[model samples]
Target: MIERWSRDQVLALAPDAASQKAAAGVSAPAKWLVTGVTGAVVWGECKGSGAKPYRACVDLSEPAYKCSCPSRKFPCKHALGLLLLWSADGAPPVEEPVDWVGEWLDQRRERAARQEAREKAKAEAEPTEKAEKVTDERRARQRAERVEAGLADLERWLRDQIAHGIADARRTGLRDWDELAKRLIDAQAPGVSSAVAGLSRVLRHEDWPARLLAEYGLIHLLAVGYRRSAELPADLAETIRSRVGFSTPKEAVLARPPVRDHWQVVATRDEERDRLVSRRVWLHGRATGRPALVLSFAPVGQVLDASLVLGTTLDADLAFYPGAAPLRALVAERHAPATPIQAPPHGIRVAEVPGLIADVLARDPWTESWPLILTDVVPARSGDAWHLTDHHPKEENAVPLLPSAAPPWNLAAVSGGHPVTVAAEWTPDGLRLLTTWDEYGRVVTL
Candidate 1:
């Protein structure tokens, strides 16, 4: 028998409170034309305003939902309602699945079988190591040639822009940069394209000329670095190539020696752009005192990997990418499931941040920011701005918070005017708080 889920458990699966409310409204037996459960599947036909009823089903084994509704949200109201009804014993047991439910189940099984076969075949395939290496080398060489040509064109364009006058460039709209950015992407240099696209943000700033000039200088340096990567240190060359859009395969990264440690997941932040979501999870090694970043991505509305929870510690082996200042890493292996933690594995004094940023920038100048866990700090408001003041009575030092950060009302509420530990991203602008530990040592998302 398939174990039944409680009403609360079913409701908790809702994407939002609105969905929960809608599901509750649709859960009554009067709203469902028919509902039945068979094996690990549940099927329901919900009455709607339309002439025909909407079909919904749930694969209880995976807790996957499907609904014939015009809703883009996952586990739409109908599906959630069906699950809720089942939880309330509204769905009676059946000897066999309805035709549509059986068809859906069969399709899922077929796809799973095909995927498994493909994976198994690839694993058992004979090795052609030497030929594969030659093919890979040829591809790498071709990509390098394309990137070099692109950088050369970019350098000429940068020179032309300066010759025409920086003021004239500023007069143009962001679309102008986007056009060139498209060309860079076509040239197989997406990293450079992203850098070019970001210039539009600089144009909006009050002191754009200086910021723009600095950005141009950095782009120029990246171009030159790639051109002369052969003369640079191995690690520095790798960093330059990476900044120019080169990527290492996951298999290769995982094959490298791993750094085993008790990794504390400090915080996670998600950013959505152009229908894509990017998640950044920050971690600190309890024993090594090293910081690492794990990034994951998914299309809008799709679920991202949520294995790394905030304020949890994992005994894992992380494989770092090749770079002068290695920070981004892959969780190559896990020794055990993550355990909850009240505070960061390690926290630094606010005053020590500048030196750490300097050290990292010296090695990877193109780095956008660094992760920081600050100890003994209280959120303070000065007129309109916010800062993190030292908790020590004798210390008169403070670090300014990022101007764009949403009001630190939550941080202030959690701190209650006392000291708290903060996890933040340290950029040139200011500190962007990510999470904090309250007076009772409870982790709170900021």
Candidate 2:
């Protein structure tokens, strides 16, 4: 059955306002013919400039879109419009997709299988491929040199802002932010470019000055980390370089030794970029109590890797990216299929959270988010703020929860004025709940 997507979810998939605006015009029933959903797919036909109507189809399972239109845009407007129609509350319930839909689905599967086979073959050939590449190494070194020079410029600019004071920097306007971000991109430091763009969100807060200071601290820390990278351990050095916008070839990372465990998929967060849909899936070792993260990317109109699902356990081998505090990992092998788990694994206490934060920060000062599980905590509201308070009287400590927590009413209701276990992201920004478990041990993805 096709999982119904919400309008917000559909809008989030759009690359730009133009695509969304165009989709909005074609959302009504009158604009489509033979519109229906069957299995994991939604299909429809829309009148087009061409003599034949354009066929629009979407796979809801993987949630990929396919439109028989010549538009270079990945989903194009027709596919967006079709999804909007399907996501609409008044959408006509559909069953049994047309014959064309079935054929298209089959072809998609075949192409995906072929792509996977080719990727596997390439992975096998990488060691030899890498060894034969002196030219590639030289180019990579040149790129690194360029990035180092960019970082030096960035550090100087950041110091000038500090010398002038953050208030002056804020007063200077958004153009400063935009211009610096552009410079990073031009210098091939794309990771820091995005990070620079993200600072705008921090500046919008009521306490913008403090947030600005923190942001400055993070940037300065990254610059220093990059400069002194070689002095750091291999993994930590890799992490610092990677955070500074250096690309580590995926094949090389996958070739590293794998960490074998019955990995439990805790929760995931997905963000869309131009070429890839980046997803970060957190995992916990059932027996080892270790935490690792898997970063996967889905090409536009392709499914994210389906092997990891929340609240499931899998026997797998994870190859972690080199870092002092290794969290980002890749699945190198799967020994068994994932099985639904009845309860969340045992969690550390709220009191222990700070020490864990300190430990990871000691390793990578730029660490933004860290995974944490709390066994007994209650959601408490004090005025306008939400907090997670330790339910245990002896070990009680109240921690401020992020303001953006998914509607707190349900979480409060689930608490029933009592304690519950939760999986969350521990960050400098504050606790952002990801999943929770009732006293009965049933898991709920927030």
Candidate 3:
């Protein structure tokens, strides 16, 4: 299939030729190694590179190209040549040059095996640990003592925030939250830290009062839960205990039954602030079919898994991370091959701005800006305000835009004489428009 397609078209679809080649090379070998779900598949391939050895990986999920030879086209010629071999009916086998490809495949197999073994060991250990009771009263007393200290620190931090006032609290920002969270971590009250961090986000929003009240209520709940853990039901007590910084081994979470299904990636959003890049992967389970949100955060520039695509479905076995609130998951398999994302159901009309806004708010009430793409744009005046109207009313959908300090409105033109609206306020970096039609957003640089 790939061979029949024009090279330009393939390269256009995948800009990183080298990466494509690497990905193709991985697929060339008959040996299929099932890597963990986030769409990881590894195979082996032999390529003839006259003088030098050739080995590469073509990651379809990321469409990434990695080759040992220094070819700039992402995956390079080796990858492309290898993929070409696989796609053919009866591909000719090139003479074996070296053990480079074999070694690479061996490493991938070893890594996969080690990971599987680790998961199996963890699963086996969960029941054993849970079955054992904390018979030592002294250990329990020490744990209680540590928790009390953490709570004391948290309460003091809250009082300080109140004394400083909301304005001052805003200025303190995430650093304040992080510092307090670390303190709680030290004191062993991690649940309090999580609550405080969530509150910090609310503080950044335009409406602080409602957010503050909700946060305060959460704090109160945490306090109450912590105090009553001894009397509460086992699960509830465990939940409270975990939230409050009680550590559970990874094996424990794996011990629980896995949530297996074809999970559709509904939305993928990332936020980078204060050296932390947080990626949220939202999946709708197709079997139990429940909506589950996973979160992964990395320090600046470190990429989290990029294989998940919004609107693409994967038959995966996901394992949640171990923590108080384990919202992070690891992918197990890519059941069905990826297809193009389907457009959003609810349409955005150029004429009905308010309706569009309302619809966007319904889906994301916290959104500060709504994204719109206009097939045909005409300047329309509503009283003293001027707005761009979309000509093909049903063609576009509203997208959420984060709040910014300035004009909060932005517009850009697409290739088909269509103009897209991005909340001007979302960082001067430009609008993060969600469009299946275009890879890049219609950026209107101020």
Q: State the C-alpha lDDT per candidate.
A: 0.90, 0.83, 0.53
- Cα deviation of 144, candidate 2, in Å: 1.7
Higher-ranked by lDDT: 2 or 3: 2
Q: Write the per-residue lDDT of candidate 1 for residues 1-446, one digit (tens) a residue.
A: 78999999998899999999999999999999999999999999999989999999999998888899999988899999999999999999999988999999999999999999998877666356566888989998898788999999999989987887788666684777888899899889999999999888886679989998898889999999999999999999999989989998889889988999999999999999999999999998988989999999999999999999988999999999989999999999999999988554568887787788899999999999899888888998898899888888788778899987888999999989877788899887889999988666678898
Worst 10 residues of 1 by lDDT: 122-131
Which ranges in model 2 have alpha carbons more than 4 Å from their true place?
1-132, 273-276, 299-301
lDDT of 3 by residue, 1-446 (tens): 12233444344544464556554554444422211111232223344445544545444444444566665654465555444443442233334423554564467669879999999999999777665544445677887888887786666666676676667556666787788778777766766777677667676567776678657655756666677668866755665676676766557655665677877665567889789998866665655634456667799978787787765677767776543323446664456676543432223344555564565444322333333333334333344444444555565433233223232233332324354332122211123333322325322232
Q: Which consecutive 10 residues in model 2 have the weakest lDDT in total? A: 89-98
- What is the per-residue lDDT of model 2 for residues 218-248, given as tens digits with 9 covering 90 to 100? 8888888888887877877888787888776
**Which candidate has the highest TM-score of all?**
1
Best by lDDT: 1
The 10-residue segment with the lowest total lDDT in model 3:
33-42
Clashing pairs in 2: 235-322, 235-323
